[model samples]
Target: PPRFTAQNHGNLKNEEEKEEEEDRRDILAHRGSLTVRRWYPVGTVLAGLYSVPPLNEVVAPPPGMATRLCFSVEYRHSCEQLMVSLLRLGNLPPRFHGNIMLVELRLLPDDRRPRQAKARRTGPDPEFCDCFVFQVSGVCVPQSTLSVCVLSVEQDGKRHAVGRVLFPLEGELGQAGRVLWRDLETEDDTQVPCSELGDVQISLMYSPCLQRLSVVVLRARGLQLLTDAGVCVQVSLRIHTQVVKIKRSFVAKCENDPYFDHRMTFKLHSQHLDEACLRFELQQPNNVHSGERPPALLGVLVLGPFMYARGPQLQHWMDMVNTPQEPVELWHGLGRAT
Candidate 1:
């Protein structure tokens, strides 16, 4: 069932307001000047059995100073599906005085049969076949600490707990917090291979009061896949805000190979944004289009930008291409210039 809440809606509004202010500043600073460049890498793997670290980390803001956090995740593997949830916990200094601001969940590969394992072979049915990558971005709230948790679940209802790194308001640079993988539990009766699942989980904790940020990466392995079968990858993003109370979600899917069909979806909270404009393109080797024809274009529906306080506002953009109607040619720009 789809999860929706009032608190989530409020957060979305706060983020929208913050984003609008930033956009206004940018536009005023560079009037009549719009620089649209490809910031995310192409041919990026979105789904895989392995785990990759977030693109960047947040720095601790000075005590009482507001800060922003930014990160991303990529997956490149032939797994049945992938699900990611981002959680934010607040108030852990002396007394738990803060609120749980955000809980975002992303469901990737909108269409696909529930994955089922094939009959086991002889010794050790190859383990660790699902791979994925993720990136997270957000701003630090004043007078609050941030904690992030990434959980990866596989087919057959097997749940694997990655790692949980903590960011404290006051702590040594390297002594923030560590995730104890050995302490995590697995649902399958079979003993989970420690090496494969060791570093699959990644977490980032930040404290505005102390102005400190800590990042940790966890990995794990299970359910090997035959290389002969081509792989499909999916990616999704969910945003949750407390100030304005909004929950926004974006989903995309694509095949690892360029010759297959892929689909993408964008979902947003209704009360947050006015409208979302999305441009899709295909970049080929030697600056060519994917096929003989032009690429298709689409737009995302957003209620408008939600308002927020001092920190950076949350804005939505499609950094990656989940599916292309035709093979993308080597050229980058918004929707084929009409």
Candidate 2:
């Protein structure tokens, strides 16, 4: 061992830090599937937070309120874009002070379940930085882009579009330690076309006489090629905390715009119709052994008591409501899950 002054001790510490960082990088060399890669932070977040109600005032939350949110993304592997992620949002708004926000991270082009961080703030902006520090094991490649979305969580637990940010990895990191900040933009700032994610079509008919709700999956469009080409469906019914799930067969890999000859029917009781819900999910099943890879979510439709009164769900709801005598067909744009 060589002895030295205070400068040598400082140099030793820096060398240790560098060695640790190299160890972490070696561990992260393989990611998409293996669970061996541990979760770690990217760095400090540089973000600009906002609110439509003018966040400078004091606001208190009402009693007995809770937030329910799911940030969903129908995964897409390629489109001449990047694949990256921000640090995990610790929680929605991190603290409650009458602030409303929804935090969502979209990375898996193959997962049906949306990953999210949801919470409510009861006052003005926090006394410190309200940064959403996201983390991931594998997505730090060149030209890869990560999306950070902030939506509004309503009292009824539905998420509405609010604002979003895109982090482009290339040329973003000038030095190894410097983090940057940017502004978040809402739909009002710019209109984003829905056709980017593509669409799915279905037909529905409810027969009071037969006491059944019938659904026919027509087709899906604009899905990522080859990898996510083969798809399947899952239909579910929930009544009084009890759930019934049915998994359908997968379409052929050759069918990009898949059409199913499949028709799903559910028995409905008049008394439960007021409180029942029907859910149809488009999923890309895992091809290898179970747990070898996570499945991606293509799209999903939830039909509930008040669903038809809403936008896309309503488009089909009213069509059948007007002509209960026949089945109604409609196409809907696929949206991000969260």
Candidate 3:
């Protein structure tokens, strides 16, 4: 018995490593806890296919001249497994053109809420089909208000106002993927006349984090139009920077308050960050009206944060009155305890 091997094989290997750490704390206390749900698609698209005339009859840009719109959207995914499942779920936003995808172009605020169905998957497969084709151009800033709220659209029906065009900032309407109002010759310019800027009620809000794209411009009431036309609308807010070449910028102002509300907050602090392209301009100083052209409200870039974490998670527990079970006082004799 005294020859029971090397110290009884180190006491049976420390009793099988304390029984595998108590069976991994009884299988992590019986597991279970994980629930994630995500869906988006909010609709709105009614400019009557570019014939321009019915936001009442366009006459809202005489205060300080501000309305030069150019909005564009062209997304086509009839198949190819839903564009490779929307480019592997990054929601396709980069180069994205043909099998088509431009996704967003901004500037809107009549009442702001046109698009519909911001999200829906309900888990299990859900028969996918996504389609979109929106095109907007500017130059009707009197009283100013242009909105196309389709946050997510492939198909839901009920977006018909079709009546506005011929303001693509005056010229150049060929590039952004091509759609030049039938080669403009000059029928009042080209197209602009459509009514029914009504019936827009869309709602679906859930935020863990990630919803930044808030642009507001309100000065219509009595319209002094930027302080009685001393003229100063120079507002520029361009976004899309991950320091690739370095060109960061941000500025805001409407002055003297006819009405100005601008808020653009996009968050995605990691993966090197950068997916919120914005470009706003209202310079206007060639003596006010060189030839009448300032009415642009292009907007639709809403991808907010819901679960972006590079920081925020710490839990260290172990204090029990400064933890001291056997260290028995080093200065316990100072005044001798009772």
Candidate 4:
């Protein structure tokens, strides 16, 4: 053995300290750090936190409240505009605290401007012949949805959602000069429904040769943010009860409608494809007070195979798998993560 020197002893001590630090980091990483990637067994994916109910069922309104809304939607293809006219409301519920009611017209997937009719005191029925014009140039009206919400103003100057009608703009509904009456659906009075959280457009592609899956976040609309802080999109790839990968898009200014245009790719073996799932979350970082807490999850959209996904989510996944390397894109309504 060589003679021991002070420098040699110091080097050995530093090496030991480095090893200890790395060991500590590894231990902490297993505590659900988003930046770290790990693998889990296949069984975890089968019975995991990602298991959620299919979003195909319509929510029935509460009994004794058969509110209905009459509106006409006209799509001016030549002018690339959509004209919405609020004709009247019938079977309205009784108001509380001497509040008045109003109607809000919103065009989905694009255009965040909501036109509100003047609030007025009415009996069981009210009429508002208000017409609002929205430019729908970039939006695909046939694939979009229109939200007609009836609201009531409280004495405290707060507005509450009385009932809402989500009308799909497709087929005859998408044609110009079409008028219809639809029943308004109501959710729990205590909280806002997940359908009001917003909507997101996602694009997915998988390549078997390389065993890679790519996901792109195109845009989101009608998002309700708590603050003015910017928001980022977080994509989590969870398999076997473990989040294997987490990626985020660049922070963009908070807006009712924001465009992410971010793409994240993951390398996945075809054997485990059936067990893999993707989670899209809108994270609103608290920029004002850094280190105060982690980013808040505004809304979430989870997509997987038929085992957990259904409706449009299942169809989108099948389209991508059937046509490998070809991209499949679709719009999904965001819901509060269960």
Candidate 5:
């Protein structure tokens, strides 16, 4: 029995419409003039398709910073000091078992002395809820950083570093009160040269008026291999065969998270913009270059325009183009040199 009701007629109509749309698309494809319809802008559509993070969103648990530490920082105006509260730690390694874990807090560069929390029984997860105060009476707190280190003490009273994280005093945490979770880098993460390349945080800005590009290398983790070595980030600008400029960050050694906080600028003309590309190489001492081979690079990252870059790299570059003169910060995972 053939039923011709309103619902049946509507279903048939939808099928016919879909078939017509497909036929139209096929015809357009054959003509090489196909343009897919989208509700959002091209950049938005591509970002969604690639699962890339929005430009404003902060990436959590950075590529190499697997271990995380939770804590809060507050500045006391009256006391003229900073108070750091130790909250809790997540993802404590299995090696911490049967040992006592402790959290240490201190200001970096100027203050080498560390204020440590009371050691607690080792467990998968532990909470300290401890408080430590650092007197910044005459010191410029804005220029300093708060370094957090998690250590495990053996029965023999030998202490070993479990993980470490560096929290800058400036930025969002500079205010009176703020709580944040930061990645704690471990030795094992960067000990061996494996498939997992480390991660680097950088900010890029391009000014059309000045015809210049600025790159700021903020911090990096999980770059060490074999042992703790002095690592410096080398930034180079190249357009095909011609090299525009080369710069390097000051070497940071023997730390979980090395903070470079260096900015390099290059004069980029409008005509060569499309072919220009920036290359980042994490270079280590001794392994600078193995004879005729290239530098023993810990990791490498590339950023360029649309034709040369893809995924998040391309998006980062496009964002700079779309909003000139504004800095765009992103966390890029380093990949082994091919």
Candidate 6:
């Protein structure tokens, strides 16, 4: 019998399963739609969420941020559940694992930190009319996103990410005080698109033996300057929550291709490399592109798991994190181009 609620409408079921469907439908009818208010004095009860300090510690969002995002969540979709055979030997009667699916939702507070909820097992297509508020204070709402994934539970208690939806959070969406019946998208689970604005060549080296990290700013090419005014390149590094700005060098008589032969090293432990990231940024005092767009960012390139990339990104991850001493020189495209 199909255990999920939103299954194939054409699929036929037995008498008992049909009776169960009627009962479930009656329950849903009794339950009304979910609504969240501007001020939830009792958020814990509305969301049905309770956690101890060790398990659900309230980790604040990053600094240099403004505005808090508040939103509600619910799911409506049909997914496949794998039932592992319990019988080890063929002699025993085959046993089918019960139909069970878990929903794990992630509300990213920032690029590096993600606020994930405890997995909720709600059969198939469990639409909780009693919605909960997901509040991430002090975050860039437009930049952040919400990810809900369906997982199949095997008899052995193993879970697999089968299908999911990635939805971006914007300020305007919350103005209505509710997000009603949004269809989840499953496009490789990436919400934002990464652009190849320009190219940058950087070298990375790590020594677990010495617990140190080093990077050399080779050069930048194919860059679009904001204005004819002189521009500068900011070479920097980010390790976990700590940010080390190596130097800000000015490029005089700036053109598209500017050569910045600079190098920086950080005293990093082998463990810190897990959260370490390298960045290349361009800046200018004035706007050059007339009537195109505001020149907030001339160009930016990021190297870390925080920024999503497809296909060769897997190879890029391996070369950047694993391959040491080789000094892999790869052409990195700018993520945000002005």
Give each model a TM-score: 0.15, 0.39, 0.17, 0.43, 0.41, 0.36
- Over 1-338, each residue of candidate 6 has an lDDT whose tens digit, in order, gives 87867766456556657767666665556444344222223322544355444311232222322211222432211221111111010111112124344444444423233223332323322222223344444334456555554444576765443444455655534334333233333323322333445666566667677666666667666766657776566666677656865556655456666676666666766666656666667766455457565434577766655443332222343344554554544455666743
Q: What does candidate 2's lDDT look like per residue over 202-283, in tens digits?
A: 7777788887878787777665443644787677877756785464645645355777757888887656665667666767
Instruction: Kindly indicate the candidate among 1 and 3 with the higher TM-score.
Output: 3
RMSD of each: 33.0, 23.0, 29.8, 31.8, 26.1, 22.8
Task: Compose the digit string of candidate 5's lDDT tens values, residues 128-223.
Answer: 778888888534777667778677778887666676776777764445555577877664554443336678877888999899999999988766
- For residues 202-272, write the lDDT of model 4, one tens digit per residue: 99999999999999999887888988888889998988688999999999878978888888999988887
* Candidate 4 residue runs with Cα over 4 Å from true position: 1-194, 288-292
lDDT of 5: 0.71
Q: Write the per-residue lDDT of candidate 1 for residues 36-73, one digit (tens) a residue.
A: 23222223356774665431222111233111111222
Q: Total clashing residue pairs per candidate?
A: 78, 28, 63, 0, 0, 0
- TM-score for model 3? 0.17
lDDT of each: 0.25, 0.51, 0.24, 0.73, 0.71, 0.47
Measured by lDDT, the strongest candidate is 4
Q: Across residues 5-63, which tens digit of lDDT does each residue of candidate 3 receive?
A: 44687788999887776655554553341221221223346778777553212322122
Error of 6 at 72 (Å): 44
The candidates, ranked best first by lDDT, are 4, 5, 2, 6, 1, 3
lDDT of 6 at 154: 70
lDDT of 1 at 77: 30
Q: After superposition, how far is residue 155 of candidate 2 from its true place, in Å?
A: 47
How far residue 33's Cα lies from its native spot in candidate 4, in Å, is 88
Which 10-residue span in candidate 1 carries the lowest summed lDDT?
311-320
Better of 1 and 4 by TM-score: 4
